[model samples]
Target: MKIAVLKESGGEPRVAAIPETVKKFVGLGASVVIEAGAGQGAAISDADFEAAGASLASRADALTGADFILGINGPEPASLAGARSGTRLVAALDPFRRRSDIEAYSAAGLEALAMEWMPRITRAQSMDILSSQSNLAGYKAVVDGASLYGRAFPMMMTAAGTVSPARVFVMGVGVAGLQAIATAKRLGAQVSATDVRSATKEQIQSLGAKPIFVENAAGIEGEGQGGYAGETSEEYRRAQAELVSGHLAKQDIVVTTALIPGKPAPRLISDQQIASMRPGSVIVDLAASAGGNVEGTVDGQTVERHGVKIVGASNLAATLASDASALFARNLFNFLSAYWDKEQGGPVLPDEDEIVKAIRVTHGGRIVSERLAA
Candidate 1:
């Protein structure tokens, strides 16, 4: 097996995967080929990969001969237009919205693995791409939000005077929200949060933050299935809006981290809520691409509304690309290892295997994954 690491085409700042890890694949009898200068943003050099026994080649020659390909993002069709058949591609692909891209890979007989579709289970934790990446995004969202706020995050006394602590409100209590709460608490902020699930209140309090329990939240409790949140009813949404309205006035910064699998993120904030915040308050919306939690958030752009800064982070992981790439590389390695049968010298698609069965998109020129087809 020959694995190729193509240069990430966009200015995404993340490498497809690290070469040091690929060296492990090489030691397992797979030849590793990386495009020259492919690991630039991740702070990896060609010499480093060469030391790991990877052959540095041009994109064309590498893709032409590689049996398996890996990337941090999607494959650009221009760079892979004429790739040879049987190139196994694995990455965090947006398979459903980009159906044409999946079709192209299928037409070329490429086995596609959508890392984002990996099941969220205890055994699959090592291979969960969404969790690995969202952890960074969650931490980054706070760092980004704190930078925009006028006041300090933590409180200090006796120095130039007494400094007050900032108040942080987290809208979602999932992986990203939990991280945001942890970061905010570490920064000395008076952190508080709310969620559709009432069960998360204890989890929020465990992180040293007060949980702002919404009134009548029973309507939305336990809506999560498979570690993901399900849609709430309109009655729940209206009641939530009324409950969240009062919390906004006191918050120095607000972070929203809600997301729905395969659907646009639910609207948790309205225009009237934005009007209640102070002038220097900031809202860091992690769900900007899926519409937004803050009203008037433009994806990948920042704008001010009612004197408040709404930060819409398009690719939060790209901000810390080097570390992000390293974490993502580890998850990708764990996932690939599950299917990699070293004794047999090829990937083994174990039927009904938890991790492999969850993310397998197109195998043998057909969409084998039910999550992608339906």
Candidate 2:
């Protein structure tokens, strides 16, 4: 099978296939073709891919007659215009939100697989793109927040006086939130975290961070399918707000990573909450791309309101392109390897495989994912 790695046009710095994984694809008995500048953003040169046995081709030539196309993001309409029927395309395509893109895939007679829909099963953990990307975003959030803050992260005793360590509060203790807490703690900041799921409290405490919970969290359940946080009631939001408001006033940095898949990010910090924070405080909202968790956050921009810095860092993982691309490429390789049929010399989607059923957004010229079909 011929596998083409297309250049990402979504302004994302990360590429779907890196040199390390390209070699693996070659080992799997697949001819790998990569766009000339596909790996440029990730500090990889055309020579690097060539060394991995991947032929360098132009964007148009790369996708033409390819059996499987790999990318970091969904392809543009123009790129897919020439895709042949039964061509397999895989990427972190946000099919749930980008319904039109899925339709485009079907219209082009392409079989689309969305990496974001990788089932959160023990067997599928290696292919979890969401967790891999969010882990990088969480670490970047702390680094960005620390750069914005005026004081030091760790407490220092100088000739002048003793400076206390910065206090960091991480909201939504998911993969991203947990990484944020870990990153902040490593920088010598006193970290604390909160989550809608009461079970995450143990995870927070395990990392040596205090776990804050809402007063009315007794009846509210945030754990959803695949252990992701589900949508919460307005009453639960109110209780969460009340609990967080007090902590907001004392925090030097706040990193919000709360997100409900396929829905707008829940607002965790209001304008009033921003106003209550001390001057020069920093807030890094990892959920900025999904309507923001902080009130003043503007996606892809850093803005100051009431003397507090609110950073809406979109595509944080892309900023660490080299490492991000490496991890993401490995994830794609793992997913593809699992379904690769040695006898058929192509990927075989088993009907009964839970991971395959969840991720196969459009197959055989139809939108096949049950969730997206709805």
Q: Pick the candidate with the highest TM-score.
A: 2
Model 2 steric clash total: 0
Candidates in order, TM-scores: namely: 0.96, 0.97
Give candidate 1's whole-model lDDT.
Answer: 0.83
Total clashing pairs for each candidate: 1, 0
Which residue window of length 10 is worst by lDDT in model 2?
215-224
- Maximum-lDDT candidate: 2
For candidate 1, give the lDDT of residue 193: 92
lDDT of each: 0.83, 0.89
The C-alpha RMSD in Å for every predicted model, in order, reads 1.6, 1.3
Q: Write the per-residue lDDT of candidate 2 for residues 103-214, one digit (tens) a residue.
A: 9888888988999988888999999999899999999999999998988999899999999999999998888899999999999999999888878888999999999887
What does the lDDT read for residue 147 in candidate 1? 86
* 33-53: candidate 1 lDDT, tens digit per residue: 898988898899998889988
In the predicted model 2, the residue pairs found to clash are none
